[model samples]
Target: MTPDHPKSRRSFSDFLLHLHPRTIPEENLRLTLSWGLGGMAVMLVCLLFLTGILLLLTYQPSTGSAYASIVTLTREVRFGLWIRNIHHWSANLLVVIAMLHLLRIVLTGAFGQGRRLNWIIGLFLLFLLLSANFTGYLLPWDQLAYWAVTICTSMLGYIPVGGLWLQELFRGGAEIGPATLSNFCVLHVAFIPATLFVLLLWHFWLVRRAGGLVQVEHDNPDDVPVQRVPTVPNLIVREAAVGLVLVAFILILAIVWDAPLMEQANPGMSPNPAKAPWYFLGFQELLLHLHPVFASFLWPLLGVAALLWVPFWQDSALPTGVWFGSNSGRRLVIWTATVGALTTLAIILADNLLLQSNAAVAVDTLVTRGLLPTALLIALLVGFYFLLVKGLKYTRAEAVMAGIVLVLVALAVCTIIGVWFRGAEMHLVWL
Candidate 1:
């Protein structure tokens, strides 16, 4: 017997239809606008989710068996290696695509004014993605995964108060062990994915609600708006095409690189230069130059807070929806960003050179680590604000774009240095 009749029952097809609008403006279909980064990222998410589910069938999260299970999955099970590699690569790629997607939003002024809440949601997603990645990194039960996670969790112990407790709460003990693995395994496979699904739904809905991408005429910024096309075939087909290319790229990497799985974790034998995961190497590298508090937490926290506050603090009413607003806006962003990059690099260089020899121990550490570097950053941003306001006469939205570019450049430089330039003992080795 069939179930009781329902009013307008929600079928699978109906749910698919409800996902996006039947039609979107033709202008919203511009590939050059958003670069399909968000769509590709979403596809990566789905790919990883499926592969991860398959892996879960045979993988054991227990400490004693975790390493053995992963080994069995990679070497014993049929096509298990391919599935694991794809899942691993897709997880890494998702973070990169998400960062690129965020950059697109910043450059295009997509998070301006009325979109403040979406910006916050995006930040939360970023945090969750990073958290998920961190938790997943430990699942392999290998040397790289073990040491990297140990270092990452230990960083939290440096927090002023209740920090150690928080660290232990996640660690499941005073140290990284079986309980810690169990906690992360649950968080990685369960909590993060569930939270991500909810946020993704909200993100997509907001995109549709916000009327899709902002229409911008390159030759004429002030020109009237363009028409939108249906999201079904036009937008959907294009996204699928881009997604196919992305999948091919990931598959090729999985074939060529096969996810690195070192010997099972040896807490006794620490790898030399035991680096954090590549995504976090930037923060670890900064620890070489700055105080732990600043490098590990405060500095990055400040950057995130600034991004969260930008939409709220900057002029919300200012005309947005265009990439860099006006032509003048583009020039302003370029010049300010260039200055900010150079300024940060110069400060870093000076601290390494001049401040290293300073006999005033307390003063040298403070200057090189925290106070002076921060003061310079503040001054640079202030200078940028004046230049945007007085020199270029920029609207608030335009200035915020420039500011974001500067921050992105600084962070990128640090990441590049950390990942490629640092040598044994975290020394700056020219690569």
Candidate 2:
């Protein structure tokens, strides 16, 4: 059919249909496939952008006016509360969806094959999304936003040599003032969004070029290639449905809970036990138990480097894109995850109980916060490395997956502690 046809003009769905293939295999759209996470992330991104634009109309980025503007917008502007709330919730959900999307890829071993480069791209996008959240959250300049940014940037300044310079770059000075707010506002609304859009399109193009989705359930390698369908009616409609549900879910959240806005920022007084945003709480939790250098910089950089190098190490016997790479890989994942979780829990529990019980293990002292935990973490990884190499006799790919699983579990445990179990002064406090 031509563009001028009456059918084409019926609704905006026609234009959207062009973006997807006409049909996909009926099995590909199964809820078990991808869990609709990638689609949900995209939908949330679009929702955030739409609502952000609306919120921007009334928001002023100046430190003096930012909080007041938010108050005005919520109170006086029509549906301003709803729009900002939608943007807020979508931003939160987008982070979660991105993480889950990556988790799915890792679990399915979909990051192997030619999908390796795309995996790196996805990692970059994750950080970009995180940066988006960090910059955007400070716009309100409330006590929560203010103190959170302050603690974070201060922690950054604790990095050894260039830390101060990096922190200064973000702060625009010694403090989070008008200049800092303006810079963050510009980056949040303009540069980051633009770059993310370009990267997202590039990512999709690569996904298509690399072969759409991994056929995880296929049993025979010699069978005829699966017939594909147009993505429009099959995949596109499903995405639309997911988008509607996501929007409705967020709408309900917005109605029941307003986005938090504490009193305007006070430069003279920092909140007791000021916290970082929920996402960074995990790192904050780790920071409290490890040396600043390890907590804030070296450890994170090493993890990234390790992940970046995974695809280069290979075992010909292991086929790529198969879950855990094989049955042996599954065993490795389970063992590593269990070890990691238990080790992580034990370290945190020990620290909370003994950091004060013995003078030798005093909190903030080198032995308690620096030497011990760092050594333990290193030992855990090294032990897992040798375990996979010797006991399991796993391939390099499987070893890598095991290591990834261990790290993910440990980080997740730390995040849980930071988000839920810590209270004033970073002391352990059960919910």
Candidate 3:
């Protein structure tokens, strides 16, 4: 066991080899199974780190010079704009890919059989990924970044208690200022990335320990022997191919689309319809129709809690490792999505009409805008759940899947409205 012994002197490749099992199920190699999302996500994170470091070479975090530095980086430095574009696009794409990866896990029941810890870790990773994006959003010190951050931080004050304290903690005072930018820079560059790196390592290790991706369970397990392939060439080759394609796609996108940069921040002159980042647009859209507490605090909290609860809700009737749990589950998803979208549209239209006609003014704001909508949403979900379970004879798991899909569809619709439909004074505009 001497330090210089051949056995002790493992190469970098050897270390990497040890990170994965000697053999993994051959089925895991199928691209359609996992959709290569997890691998794509890993590639995106690597790109983010690489490009972020390059951008840091010129990015000035100070309020006075941040915007100017960005301008110089994009216009003056060689390949600076491309690097920034890659970082921007990669961050946004990572958010999306991470979410889809989570959804794949849920639909395939990959979180079952003592994998709950990894599921929780995955959820935290998603949250941290979002935090990373939010912190980075402010570094340019542009109007878009400043007001968007302001609106998001202001929403924090809607919490039941200690809301103002939380708001100040993020804002660094009563408003977005010098301290806020410095704090976010430290978080984005030092704390958040460091934490994400550690968590990502842990996540990968857990996946490896769990014997790679979950395989589809056959009805008669003993009838056929499970086939496994060596991890070195089989899994590694597929991963390498995916990484190459992903890198090429990202580079092309970065070249084609430059990251947006608005004028330097002028806090005194807010935009006509200042909005949060697109991810949070669902919440902003909710605020327009509901009370702040429900939109900003309660509904989001509930959604997250439901996600956290997913792994614990076990049903023997539902098959594991199958898309949407079963054929019936797939139909449930379709029905839920269609009904959810139409219902959301109807509600929005009705609410808009009420406001325009001044009919909503007669009721208390809390009742008309907050409690009623919240109660209605709950009732609809609960009623739909029962209908699926009792009337349709679906398993509880399928019912839960329906509920989640419905809520997600509603949120997606709201986000679309917020991003494309909202105009001056946050009013709905067809264009």
**Arrange candidates by lDDT, highest first: which order?**
3, 1, 2
User: Lowest-scoring 10 consecutive residues by lDDT in candidate 1?
Assistant: 1-10
Q: What is the model-wide C-alpha lDDT for candidate 2?
A: 0.80
TM-score of 1: 0.90
Name the candidate that leads on TM-score: 3
lDDT of 2 by residue, 1-431 (tens): 88777677545455564344445556567767688888899888899889988898999989889999999999999999988888889998898899889877877667767787888888888988999999998999998998898888988986889999999999999888887898889989999999999888877767766667666546784585667776756777777788899889999999888888999999888887788999988889878767777787767877889777776566422353365667767776777778789988997898767765765643455665666767867897778777777886777656766777778888899998888888888888988
lDDT of 3 by residue, 1-431 (tens): 67777675555337767778878898889887788999999999999999999999999889999999999999999999999999999999998899889778867777777578899999999999999999999999999999999999989999989999999998888889999999999999999999999999999999888888888788798987789888877888899899899899989999999999999999999988999999999899888878888889989998999888877877622356678987778887887899899989888888888877884364227776778878987898789878888998988878877777788889999999999999998989998
Which 10-residue span in candidate 3 carries the lowest summed lDDT? Answer: 359-368
Off by over 4 Å in 1: 1-14, 217-226, 314-318, 336-339, 354-368
Query: What lDDT is reached at residue 246 by model 1?
Result: 96
By lDDT, is 2 or 3 better? 3
Candidate 3 regions exceeding 4 Å error are: 1-12, 316-318, 359-364
The residue pairs in collision within model 2 are: 21-230, 21-231, 21-232, 22-230, 22-231, 23-229, 23-230, 23-231, 24-229
